[model samples]
Target: MTAFIENDVHAVAPEVAISFFKGIMPFDTLDEETLRSLARHCRIDFFPKGTRLLTADVTELTHLYFIQRGGVKAFLEDENGEVTLKDFRGEGAYIGALAIIRGTPANLNIETVEDTFCFLLPRDIFLGLIEKQASFAHFYLKSFSEKIVTTAYNELRHHKVTRRSNEDLYLFSIRVGDLVKTLRKVAASATIQEAAALMSEHRVGCLLIHDAVDAEKIVGIITDRDLRGKVVAAGLDFQQPVQTIMSTPVQTVLSQSLCFDVLLKMMDTGIHHLAVERAGKIIGVITSHDIMLLQGHSPYYLFKEIRGQQQISGLYPLANKIPDVIRGLIGEGAKAGNITQMIAILNDHILERMLTLLEQELGAPPVPYCWLLLGSEGRREQTFKTDQDNAIIYSDPEDETQAQAAAAYFKAFAAKAIDHLVNCGYPLCPGEVMAVNPLWCQPLSSWKRYFERWVSEPDPQELRYATIFFDFRAGFGEAALAESLRTHLNQHIKGRDLFLFHLARQSMETRAPLSFFKNFIVERDGEHKNRLDIKKQGLTPFVNFARVLALKFGVNETNTLARLKALRDGDWIQAELWSSASEAYELQMQQRLVHQLRQIEAETIPDNYIDPADLSDLERRMLKDAFTVIERLYGVLDQMYPVT
Candidate 1:
């Protein structure tokens, strides 16, 4: 490669510095103040071909390079004085992250592939930024450096690849207003032909429809499909008002809302486009096309497909495709929790759609009701498609006759839902903790009474059942009902010494299979002999720990990691312990998921029984470390809420 400048000729005008970093990774999310600081420290450097920018044997690292316009290649040196090309980095690529994070010498040699213009950050500033900015840390955490390079190389080597935009990949913190830059608008009085013309001119699929009387108020939206269907299919007048073809109440997301939640709402509503409202006024529009990550077979698409199904037959195909989605996410190096969380959300969509189908078949219900999820589903952590652990809480009727009628109505509803779910591959919950069971299906008043009874006067059996239900979330209908129930339970049960004591006692039933000495205590004499049930042994202990911790500290988050973060943020637990628990939980979940995926690949039923021997030296070490963290947390639990 050739360059116009030498090492000494490295600098850029201050005016264009911020704009230059606006679309780059790790820099796009930084604020103006931070960006200025970066600009102050940053310098522009040009390197020629065969230039040794960094060497594998260097004792120290000095700069972090961001490729501006050309490419850089990384090489690994062998025992001989020769080096092999390990990976290549193109535009927007980052180097020196591994060295900076490790606080050690550079591990690979980096050279310009061509005349490369690079934006360079001093090693100290780069380290400081990642340490202070959680977003920067998380981006690196979510990506594997070498793997990223490999993916880029493969895509470069093969066919043309469509890449995610800077906003989609790195602008998780930046708002919709920042995302879209401009809001497209149309008057409600505009004709269909006029709206189509406007859309065509703008090269957009949809426009936010404004109110006729109040121009500032966004009342509805019209899409290209709206014109094609609501206009042409129905043979409507071309001069007719656009409001007739638009979708109303306008599913609006706050302009300040993060892109993740924005995508989630789009997924949940199956609305491909949404209007962004800032301070109660429409400002911009965002679409599924904008967020390129939501592609084929993604959770969002699956949920949208689920919502479209009018019956169970169509749902089978969507539900069956879930495993493939999970596999795809795993292949993409998505976080284990994220894959499970997406699965949980998709499963809820299936149930919600099924409930909608049932309600339609049986007609509207007699009262307000909430369909609650229990166990892993409630906690938002699920792997394999599993049985239903759900219950219903309906509003109490006035008299005994009305109660009987209400019971009759819900009983029929529950039976159909359970059977439908079973046909869709979600088995009827084995423990009879299903909505079809009268005991689990009860009036809202009855639910309150039951929770009070369970906590105030606990039994071993009731405690076991209570633990399963405590992680409650609404899958469908009246989500507020679920939230109200949680608030009530927390108000009464949190910090009640006697209740927490019993709950802790019940939670301690499962023990971690590994010891601090790094020895595995495998089950010796069963169908799964010499195999450890990692879910029961490794995960259950952490679950119990989180449940008790959340209850004790009044943290309302149901997920284990969420509870730990809440506790740490609230100063209820030390940072060291919280970090340990969080890491340990992730490690266990990741290992369990890999094990299940292995089973699926082998064409065998996926399960929790894992042999320590199957794990590598690093995995074995991680498993031990995770177990040790749990054991320490257990010791803390034993001290705080001693059962004996």
Candidate 2:
């Protein structure tokens, strides 16, 4: 390996090295003085194809190499000699930073894929820059999760008018612990009057109730509203134990949790207070007010308004506020996953209120039923534009007359509920896959039969149904029915390898839209010419692939991100592969969301189509990287289940 390498003194030409470094990131942020210093210390080396630059366990990495020309392949080899490809680094890509920074031997076997030229910064020079330059060091020191999100966010901030300044944006970065200034606790045996008096004296709106037997053990929570509603409004005795009106079990968040996540949790659960804990000990309390005080706009308020509204007419306009809330969250640098979860929670609130109003007007349900949120909604991945993909699963009927009654009541209930949702801006499902569709709205027994048949008699058409229906989650009603149905579905598919093969084959049908030259394979001529269907080409492959693997492993998570995490946790997928796939999914989601927001601003219907030409150079490059990751992910599926 040393014999094939040659040094070139000309590689450190200050002007050329500075220019090249300026084009690549982190280095691009550096001052001319630092770049010159780096150039002066750097040496360029040439290696022939098949040259081993660094081998795991065999070589110690001494320098960080910035690829100037050609490429290298990084992989791992097990004791059995089975190899796993890690990544391919080309021009503008760098290597050995992770190893050099961590002061460890190379974890990957790095070899030149072709005759390659690289500018090498010695260990001393690398460490010097890491210590002296904050920005350059941050790029490498940040965790992969933070790096991908911040990279996309910084790009967004550069392109858009993000209303919040850097300082204001920092509010979202504050942890739950940082916001906890007080921890008020009351014994469960305390009278309601005494608890309210303590709250008043302390100027607190809520108190964490601890067990009389174990004062440190938080048992329940009682808020100002609970005093007014559960005590005064209900005409309960003021001397009654606080436990009479207190709610259990107390909601708690880790001290390390972001205030942004805390706000989302409050909104999702319709709660106002959360206990903050550090190292398993309750330390303080953080409320919605504490988080809301940091920002002018909050979805928590909007979520509250939706929950308070009783009439469908009033709820109609609240749905329109979702886009503005999403925009505010994006401006505040909320992550793609958090934003999607917020959207799902807001949508669920609106639907829940809508159904409640229906039950009031049309009378209570005739039988216990579960309202199923299917497809993207079920996965909690809704964006700006989504139509209804819902279903209903009712309990088994007791008799023919009861069955007739349930059928009539739900038929009318689903149609009216869907109409109200439509008035609130939800479009109808294009495939008629909503609660109002008879095929989708059925008894629990029928749903079980549907899954059993689909699993045993796997076909392309049934696989399509499996792709959508398999992601069902109970949005409302008896959730037990949904859980029972899931158990039944998993049971039937437990030993069914052929079903998994068919599902994998279905996933393979949609390939990444990249070509041989690494350019986008977009339509040449049409209304959508030069535009890529971001959903079908970019997002579907991930959704499909995650679903396929989740099914094969009997992982019950419905969300793509959650499924990927479960797979990684169960050791079903490699950690590196999970990281790549997760980052790719998130980056693509950010692109699609920004695109949809732009369309909404233009007063046009939001869509999944994105024109690569319209994207900034940074976004386009990241998107291409995401696409490359997707293609590699499919390779794993291919090796598992070869589609002939």
Candidate 3:
């Protein structure tokens, strides 16, 4: 195997190459000597087109290759010489490593489609190096565990989809303990009447003929309809092989396929049953009945219900059913994130209806305006008991008088809508930050002035406005109005280092809810005495960190999670940091959901505060971990943007 020098490999976009190395095995935690040794063993080799590096039938492997450039395709060929493409590997991926490590023949044939350059290391040398280097061994084990975890997660998600589709199709796999019909061996020349008698004796809807050693590889299936229409109706001889009338070329799916995908296939083809295949062998059959029964209530009906609501009052009933809808989605095994997104969509529709009704009650606005959603609503991460945190932005007025008139008109309209939303189940914003607040319903110039004042001369009181108002997402109105405001803010905040520093410092002000000993830090005294303020302690920190990064990076995205992802993708923050922040956000949101569910159960209004006594030990630990992530992120931000 050819080896390449580490310096040569590092020469290509060195920083990114180093990052990729640090993220993977061996190099991730290698000592200087181990790193040097590995680098010495690593040789970069080039393969021309049509080169076969590994074949399925190859019983031994001496080296593992890591692709540095170009692409390779791994495929399997059947007896008929038809090749099935399994996977494609390119840069930053290991090729033929699994077979080399597992000491098995390659499950797939790897061939270069074009000229490819890769780092090669002899299997024995790499194994010996890993054994001698503790850090290398640790990194390898961790990498393997992570891969297994990721693969398991993907499989679980796939299975969930399959299980849900099974319910929708009203299909069920026969259990070993259940009484099932058993058929004796039958030759291809077996009489049709004899097979019919056996099927009748078994009292089954269909007959499975066993011609091969593997009973599951059913050569033919005879349903009652087939017997009646093909045999009895035609007055055919009873002493004929069942295969003569059996359906040929049966369709099949791998057990690994998602259920919903299978359901879609069945629906498209107008077929009920699909044979389950693994490694080109049939195991069992999944029927349409199985899929239908497994599928829970469809969300399409809910969408239709929302669309059919004519007035604001009509939305009240649907809004009330929102919790049930979420519960149904959860029951159907929808991912928490996906369920939240769907709920947000439904909430948007309800809010839209309220806006429509408000517009009818109070005539159209005097000036072009846009209704803005703030906080979680703006982020589309709202739960069942979200509050109204919105504002209105109209075009700059021709004069002060016209601006006042436009602001007043929007304020009144917002107030009406807020009231409708309250009646529909959403509580009014506690901070009075809604559009109904006279300070919020303003012209474009006034909004810009508000933002400029907040940015140019930052104050503790105004910082609150900056945090919430900065996250404004267009809920309703002229799209251009919001865009113009966004453009203005983006332009003003780009080089304003002081503003960013202030934002970062302000973000760190919210002390994480854990004490020195890592115990819960309850509220000192208030209406929520002895309670943990989840919003103030958990959610706000992540929100602040994301906001600071967004401002510094001139990222136009408003949603906190989106901002975090954008920053990570833009290379502003490391992936691990982004992942930690995201996990913290998700954990906090889940806690908030639990709190909301409890409130709904008790028929009480949900709030951000939660009593520590109510939390389980596991939840308390997760909460602490979430806070720690935020605390670390705050430290990073502090270092990046030091206080003046």
Candidate 4:
């Protein structure tokens, strides 16, 4: 129905405006005096259903409309006049904040979905509030994203499980610099006795060895373990140069790196101590002891146990305990990203150990190669229910004899690796995408040809392969091979606009599990009756959307969050849209993890289906909101290349 604002109306009372503002956020954060000032300037208007309150054609937004009653639909309209719905916002939601704050036309349309009563704050008042109120300004800028993330984990805050010593906060929020106490260094020419004396004097666990010529340049490092195992135990002369005993190539992390990531690095590299660097210079050192002190029951112990295990049978029990550790982290309020990264770290350790054992049994390969992880594993976003999605990429062989030998060795290696991983609880990829498939285990040249064919000759089958293989990352072995393959893949897809268009269209094939009225559209019948495939329907859209844009723009990041961040920083996408997509992805991931965790706790095999009936009211709202964010992202893609 065509609509208009009521021409006849009484002026909105200040008390009424103040009352409404106090009930919502940002405004509720304001002081009473500031609220009164806003109330004094506010005016009310009633618009009939289908009223075009704002649109892309407007030169500038005149007022910020706060929905006092009823709701509105915001959407984008492309040059072809095809509309893509962005969201259904109800009471407490505001419109024109983006346009007014930027002094630009509305980037999308906001129209009344029902008979809507709105409290209108003029552009001048809104700008004045923004300039004078820091909290109010931050809300429009980024606080909404915080609310989105924090609200999603509200259930975690109230979980009845036994609480640990705030380990989640320490792991995710504390930086490496926070734990590093001091930097202790010695010249490479210093005697082992002098290094030991320095360690004793400072009461330190390790000492960084600097270059003999350049005092500022660190050349190596020696820890207490090295002093005991290499010097004391081996009966080396105490007067020998420390360089003879020092372990070359010290591990270092930036001062700002998270404790969680530091722990992962320590566990993965089997290092007890790491130098902490700021800019390019080492400032201090952090030990695994320091991290473990923050969380005495952390995964460091489990990782140590995994590293010490000699056989695959020993890893099975350890692998099963991982879900419990992750659940405990979640119960303590760790974010989805941190949880997944921790899972990936542990999984990587198991894979590394399994490969090492297998190599010992089968002998070394004929050529240098990398075990490439694809899809979620590649992105380091593994959850409890992950399967093997891997491939093998080896160097080009010297000759036919060499080629045959290389193929036979890796063929056996892949089969053993896959079997060992399955024994350790990682299921086989249903599609045979794992390295065990001879089709996927290939030399560098073959892998390059595969990517070129997939990107250049776009088709349903080819794009399917593109979607999976494009997210490859080297999990183990020679990383250079994987890096070279990534370079080749990115170069091939560059400037391939048609391929991107087809990819984007294919990405949208699995529609969000949302309906026209913003209700969840679940399965009609079968085992998943009344449930939705959260992984395929809720999660994959975000992954695919980011992949298409990242591919088009040559973003080399494999992780969804990182790709979205690159897109946002480059202004390839709107900052607000980036926040929405990121928060949405995290929330859905949290849902998926909690669901899988419950299944594991019940001793049942975990899957992706989520019943709307199982979610709390807030969770349901968050899920619906996430689905809306996915559609908005799709709208952006549609604007780029309309899927006709």
Candidate 5:
């Protein structure tokens, strides 16, 4: 079906020439002769600011816009006249190909963001070019991906702030010394009257009360709220020592610690102020106000909002807002691990609450049982809501007859909890790996038996089913049950060369889809033909790689990054290897998340498969870099533990 233009389309005028589209994408993929033939039909057009570039209802979208200068924004107007900005194109970009190729009226209106200049190629010519170049054809077919990058770029523009570096944006990178405005120090023995006077004089929210014995040591803190709640409200004597009203055992953070993690400490403990310590002495203080002003809608706000929920039904709306929060954070350049960790934390609260509510309805568990989160959720690396991989472990019953009754109660509780979770947006596990499955809802001793059997006799077919169990961690309930199992499993597997080798061999079975020629190895056929499965091919390689190393080192950390860090700290892995592998894993996760969000926004089922051609040049290179790192790591693993 090769399309050979009948002949070069002669320029309608001097301004319409083949030379116009020389370096533009898609056009760049064209050979000189073909490129010239198509460019002959291209005409340069100017669009003034506020001018309509394209109308949504136009019966014929005759032009394919390739921007040469300035900018244009595409928007979709829905019912009730609400308009959502869809995409933006600047110089070296193109638009209108999707609508023109599909032969459907585009549900978008393009308007000039500024006075813009573009090379317009007629719709008929563009289709002819698509048939001529496979690369050019692919670029247009991945409209969703192209839309995602443009939308993300627009989001970044909308939220861009001046006078802030990447370090300033990340709470974890902000040092306590960098955030403090002033240090107000006071003696612990200072009278409440004197403290009130100093507070009034300084107009500060809190005072760093030093220890009576060691002047350099900050023993407690007193805030305006403390004075109001403890003295003014409770009717305590105002003349008494400030220590009486001051909060003892004050929360503190190292001066060099990340402000974001420290903020989490304050939020977790309901502390308004935290003393900043440098070396061994008090340096300054950081208040909730400081973080609030610096970080808008911090994780603390989300944490409080999640925990404040009193009913399961109320969580739906709040949960819906989470995607916006994630998208905003990603736009602002937050790390993928940190973003996913925050999500996993918030999700834990929702699931734990659901379980608590179910307990109230179904009556308390017949025995102490731990609700274990497995797979990505267990690893705290869940970027998208896929399906719940969970199981329950209960105390072993004394009598064999009692086991049946206890299992039934737990199975019922698990079913109710899973049903509620599904309502809250977590889909049911397609593999039937959830706790409601009786095979997974087992007594602690039974779980031990399951692990021992898998380790002792490693069957590849059986290993696939039982392997993810190693990543399990207690999400709620009696954590001791999960803890005991982890200890038992680790002790059994440690130094078992055969078991570790088998695990490594099994993990090595999946390889990152990076080819020697530096092109992605995509699906050859089926529904996702020619698409890259970033999860199974990209993410799973690192997940499996890290799990093997963790088992080798007896590391209990479930997170891929955490496991790598533990290995690095133990001097078991080279620093360079750790950095590259970590970066590669993060890049893959971020790519998957970005792609999944696009699917969700489009109201389609979110998936890991992505069309590489849709990615901008920069993104495609970065993807290759990430895959290259994974390939290198696999080479090292193969050398160390060769398969028979």
Candidate 6:
């Protein structure tokens, strides 16, 4: 009886190990018996720090190792004694899975960074285990498929970044040099009056001072603040030597450091100015104000400055510069989505500036009001040339005269602002769905009544209007005002199955770009003839699909991509399908950016069309793959909301 009990205990140990493996591995098909057999043959090994598991010369070896704990760094050492790290791997991941499965020599050296425990299964044992168990084989196949997908995605991203042709490197160098203050030097013996006049004439804040006796030595610095505080405040003569008042032991930055790094250091040290020095000589000076301005002044910054501006016309110059700022961000390789969000935020600032000016011109609102951004602007996804789609919502005043006065005031302000925005490059909405429209500019109660009408009666025209307006995001004014509107909509629409079905049907109006031959179908007419309508065909389907799902589920997030992700997380959509849809959207956006960049290089305006003849074979193939994803998503939409 004692011997039998011991045998049972030993037999169960592999089952326990298999359970642990099953939890982390991506195989849903693996059964208990198959896992037990695989686990019994897997040998657990412990290695101390510096233990190398594989080397570059080890070819034709087929074995897989799973790290249970500790870390490993895979790297390649060159003949020049330089080492480049390939990747870092930690707990629950298999190393050599790719190479082992492919029967190739290790492309990288893997060594333990610390004492590590890992399960090692030889190729023959792994194959034998899989052959005996159908479930185990299925899991292995799925794992391999996932790895291939991941590798493809990574390669795509790498190609996208590398194709920019060193533009990022050149821009980074210039920005860093400017931030580090590399320029010409001045003398310490210069008079305060001379320094102040030079600063004013050059429109510079600080001047670097070098020693007269030793030209290689940097002695001090003088800034506009030094003139105001040290010279003027002290009631000293303007003719006094700048060296008497200039800051000594000048703060310096190395020429090689990154601009962002220097900015952080300056912020940390609370210094307004930093001098760039090379071999003990002052090269140039960078002031806090210069950094702030070059960093791209925010809407808040503009608002603060515009508030003190005596003339309303002063806001125009700043508003005009918004497009240039956006171009600068794009040149710096800022993500498109992030750039759009920043633009939207800054647009709000511009709106606030206009509102402040208007308040002075027209007085405060007779009732509390909110200015709502609609359509893509409301979604905070405006690019450089997005049009105005906005409305006004205000609390209903008890007095009819007071309410009419408030509406008139807001409408006038909005009309003026819209005209300015058009001058600033944002065209007016073609449909005139703007706050200046009396129907759009309404009290909160009227807005609710309009939405209720749209929700209760599911007509085609009304559904189209609701689709645009439902993506409303607060641009300027009391956010609670927009929230109140959202709350009312949510309450009325939740469990209103008819409204959702209509929305779903309307969303299906735009089909995916896939042709019968699994190729992208190009536009037949209009300005984009023979070219793909990327925005209309590739992006809108996903965006519309996400929007309808979000509305049905009552997910309030406005960004299209965020809405899709939220729906997936809530299990309203499958994870794999949503992931594929997101990848397709990203690829489409990336192609658009590349086209836009080319147009910029050619000094022409960019558009959303991409001619198939213009793309490389690889890009053409990738675009097809992306279209396939879109088609799959459309299938999901059709299944969920079939058109009668």
TM-score, one value per model: 0.69, 0.78, 0.58, 0.75, 0.68, 0.60
Taking the candidates one at a time, how many backbone clashes does each contain?
1, 0, 31, 0, 1, 0
195-249: candidate 2 lDDT, tens digit per residue: 9999999999999999989999999999999988988899999999999898999
Structure candidate 6, residue pairs in collision: none
Provide the global lDDT of candidate 4 against the true structure: 0.85
lDDT of 3 by residue, 1-644 (tens): 32222243322343444544566655677555555555655566677767777878674666777777888887766467866334677877776555665577775678887788777767987777667777666555556435433332222233222233333322123221121123333444567887788767865555555564655556766666788999999998887777787665567677666554565466445555566666676666665555544535544345557767777788887888777556544434343455566677678767766787678778877788888988778777788777789888888878878878886787678777888888888888889988888888878888999888888888787777788888878887787988898889988887888877877887888888889999889988979899988877878888888888887788888777789999999999988788767866866776676567557767887788988786644356566877888778978987998765
Residue pairs clashing, model 4: none
RMSD of 3: 18.4
- lDDT score of residue 377 within candidate 3: 82
The candidate that achieves the highest TM-score relative to the unseen native structure: 2
Off by over 4 Å in 5: 1-176, 190-206, 222-248, 256-258, 264-272, 357-366, 398-405
Candidate 5 residue pairs that clash: 171-260
| Per-residue accuracy of model 1 over 345-372 as CA lDDT, tens digit each | 7888888888888899998888788999
Global lDDT scores for all candidate models: 0.77, 0.85, 0.69, 0.85, 0.76, 0.70
Q: Which portions of model 6 miss their true places by more than 4 Å?
A: 1-334
| Clash count, candidate 1 | 1
RMSDs, each prediction? 8.7, 12.3, 18.4, 11.6, 12.7, 13.4
Model 3 weakest 10-residue run by lDDT: 171-180
Error of 5 at 244 (Å): 5.5
Superposition TM-score, candidate 3 onto the true structure: 0.58
Q: In angstroms, how far off is 113's CA in candidate 3?
A: 43
Q: Write the per-residue lDDT of candidate 4 for residues 1-644, one digit (tens) a residue.
A: 55444473446888999999999888888888888888888889888888887766564688888999999997655447765335689998898887788787875677888998888888999998899888888788675457435745855344323455554446777899877776789999999999999999999889999999999999999999989999889999999999998887988899999887888788767788888999898998899888877764578878888899998778888888798778767875777888898898899888898888888998988999999999999988899959889999999999999999999999999988888788889999999999999999999999999988888889999999988899999999999999899889789888888889999988878898899999999999999999999999988999999999888888889999999999999899998898889988988898888888878878899999999987755578778988988789888889998957
Residue-level lDDT for 224 in candidate 6:
76
